[model samples]
Target chain A: MKIAVVGKGGSGKTTTSAVLARTFARHGHDTLALDCDSNPNLGISLGIGEEATEALVSVRDAVDAGEEQHATSMDDLVSRFGVDAPDGVRLAVVTAIQNPEPDCP
Target chain B: MRVAFVGKGGVGKSSLSGSFARVLAEAGERVLAIDSDPMPGMAFSLGLEQSDAGLPDDAVEEYEEDGRQRYRLREGLTGTDAVEQYAQRAPGGVHFMQLGKARGPQWNNRRQHFGFQRLLDDLPGDGWSIVGDLPGGTRQPFLTWGRYARTFLVVIEPTPASLLTGRRLARLAETARAPRVVAIANKVREPGDAERVSSRTGLDVIGSVPFDPALADADRLGKAVLDTDPDGPTATAVRSLVQTLQKSEEQS
Candidate 1:
């Protein structure tokens, strides 16, 4: 079963989503936590850590322009962009804004 | 007025927005604060105990609106009915709603996001003030999303990264035709910090929240800043910001 957590900003949405996703994974269920927020933070929140989240390429970056995706299949979508989190929970970020800084001039 | 609180991540936008909503509500205005950020936190700032910030009853079903797929509160309500039924009341009589955040397939669906955006945009404008805490950065709000707001407030900090982000955010908000776009320098350690931000961004620096030990304690303990120290420095600055905005609205 899929569960969605929604709430106002700083309203514990990430915390709730992280907890629920972790709980499901612990219960022997195949779980995935999708981070769609441009301000993505579920990585550290879910104990995935910063390095792994930084290495994650959003699906927007993964899929090539004009590339055709199977109408009903998510295999291509997951393989190219998804990052594996701790405890068998996978993470897929939909889109992320690129930070415009490169460690100062 | 529809106001959007946006800026760099972790710049106290959520706290300021929630507090501003409370300030308006306490002043006898009907206020609805929408948590539109995906990494939601406005609910905690509003001091609500709910873990699920979406509509009550796990409402994430889809429906067809105008030949486009959209998400809705499952109570079969629209507009005012939806607001009245699903909005949760917080401290100072502010009503709160969270745009739903889902995982897996639903996360990548633009239709679902747009549906929520349409709901926010279609909200009754007159006699009601809507405050949304938008996701951090310029991309999400500028790409056909900032139109939902009449005014945009960028919360910045006394740092290179945050000021640069605030500059981009301010330009985007103005480009999107937000009638009013301004900035607030948060976590100011010195009086010059706010001046630096205003000079760099060229947008009015409406408020300056000091770096208070009480606020740090509140954040570390996951407590709302206002509730932790109602008369603290940061809260006082937030109140001044709200009052200034209200006065400007009255004048305009």
Candidate 2:
């Protein structure tokens, strides 16, 4: 089933969500944990080493850089970017925007 | 059963949320957690380093491409396929994705659709619990998603603003047809604080937590309070919250 944890800043939304994700992963079910917050620190809670992930490139950036067309087809996105399932659990990222400041170590 | 934990700012919702999840995991329950807030500092409280999962600048595309809403990001990521490649699998067996940040336009449309919600169709089976950490405000995203949740937990404080919002949330939940609504009092120091808030707001108090400096210190140092103080008052309160909710669900 799906569960969502939401609260104000300093109210423990991220901590609760991250811990729940870790706890679920520990329980051994194929689970997907998502950190869709603007502060962007869910990767750190999961013990990821760096802030860099190939999953972050955006369609807007591709267009701004002239990497794609003004109206790229959805089929083009799947063919060029999507990949087969990976080892362990599956992790995905979705957001409306990125941070102006770098949130890396 | 699924559980959604929601509250405003400074209510210790994150600590309680993560701690409750830890309690369930220790008891052999499969739990997945989703963080939907903009600040995204819950990582430190969950015993993980502080880092971002995705970059917002590239995640969503905003153009009225056609009659349908089309979005694409990450040159090598999934498109229109209803899934993205930026999600990362955590060590504890949970697969995680980044909702990153919302642009001003998307934030304005917070009442609309959260692209992440699409993952609901891809969740696990029964006996699994999922928790999401949301932002501080009682805006459309929380209210809208609150409608979809089977159980809604509102975090409250003794202050008028907090209690007022808590009650408003309860009414909204009732209006939206949430499966269940419960309130939690965080950092309760004054006697009858929860009761006072409840009596004035006319909402049931299902949980309470005491203030602790250890939690604040952990936040400053970038560490999980569980790792620092598992037996602390806040932790114990959170564990009890899990048991209480689990029992409530069982009885239901």
Candidate 3:
């Protein structure tokens, strides 16, 4: 069950996402928790404050290369939506924006 | 003509937002609620099928690569047109204007404030309440909303962790000079949690909702709680919130 929680910054999203991921993982799933925060703060929410993982694949990179995804339909995108969990859910988190709008300054 | 709902993640931002738009629409407002998150929600959460109608990547690249930027703000259209030229309507009476990941993404991410501001200023005034559902991060909207939206409704959870983040967001909202800023709390299982969090952060706890299992169950079933459990406590709480917001705006 790959689930991606999307909202604006400061919305407790990363923490909620982290907590949700942990909850899913503990429910006997091999979870692939990805933090696409760009600044990446899921660590503290998931209690991995000191440890980290590579930020997930960026939507920007895929588009910049001019590669067209075969599932070019919004319906396809909708069907593929699920919580980012391993085993029970093979979640591929896409978190990078075309331009980091408020560009991490 | 645009009302933006922004807040910490999982702070009932989306729920409050959907209801807010719904209330406005029910009251005869021309509501054009938009979900701009690349992660594609709001539709399901709002009980509407999603739409892919918006700018495509290859199309954007073609315009940019050919040195023809469509969507111009100040100088008007020089080479290409604006995003509204190709905007698509989603189901449930909402016109969806998506800005998907571009082909060959914007190279200038850092300090591109002027360009970003102009882009936002250029959005077509379609005579509809432009209710935007932004991405779950501060970086994107801080730049865009500062130039685009005048009113900001932020939702927060009453937890220690959420309040800490909410404080940071309040300061940011103040600095950006958002014309109006208000905070609402979601998942309020404990009594008095909203007050404590609001005081600690020095921001108004405009609204608060008790955590409802009805909402959780709806999400588990991949259905919108609003449509599934309209009579539940969660729905009542959201209704109260919408009324509160409307009253505040009236008084202002």
Instruction: Specify the highest-TM-score model's number.
Output: 1
Native contact fraction (fnat) of model 1: 0.09
Best by lDDT: 1
DockQ of every model listed?
Answer: 0.07, 0.08, 0.13
Winner on DockQ between 1 and 2 is: 2
Question: Please, what are the lDDT tens digits per residue for candidate 3 over residues B1-252?
Answer: 466776545555556666566655656656656555544456555655555544443232212436744432334531114334444443344444443322245754222233333444555654566666655435445556434565666667765545655655666666655577667777887888888767867877777778888877876665667778877877787778767766766786
Which DockQ-derived CAPRI band holds candidate 3? Answer: incorrect
Per-residue accuracy of model 2 over B1-252 as CA lDDT, tens digit each: 466677656666666665665566666776555566545455555666654554345444544466856444434433323233443334344333334345565544321133444344334446456665555534433344433356777888775546655755665555555678778888788879989768856778888887678878877787768788878887888888888888887898
Give TM-scores of the second chain, every candidate.
0.87, 0.78, 0.75
Docking class of 1: incorrect
lDDT at residue B91 of model 3 (Cα atoms): 32
Global lDDT scores for all candidate models:
0.72, 0.57, 0.56
Off by over 4 Å in 2: A1-105, B54-66, B70-97, B100-113, B125-127, B141-143, B146-148
TM-score of each: 0.66, 0.59, 0.61
Better of 1 and 2 by TM-score: 1
Q: Candidate 3: where is the Cα deviation over 4 Å?
A: A1-105, B56-70, B73-92, B99-126
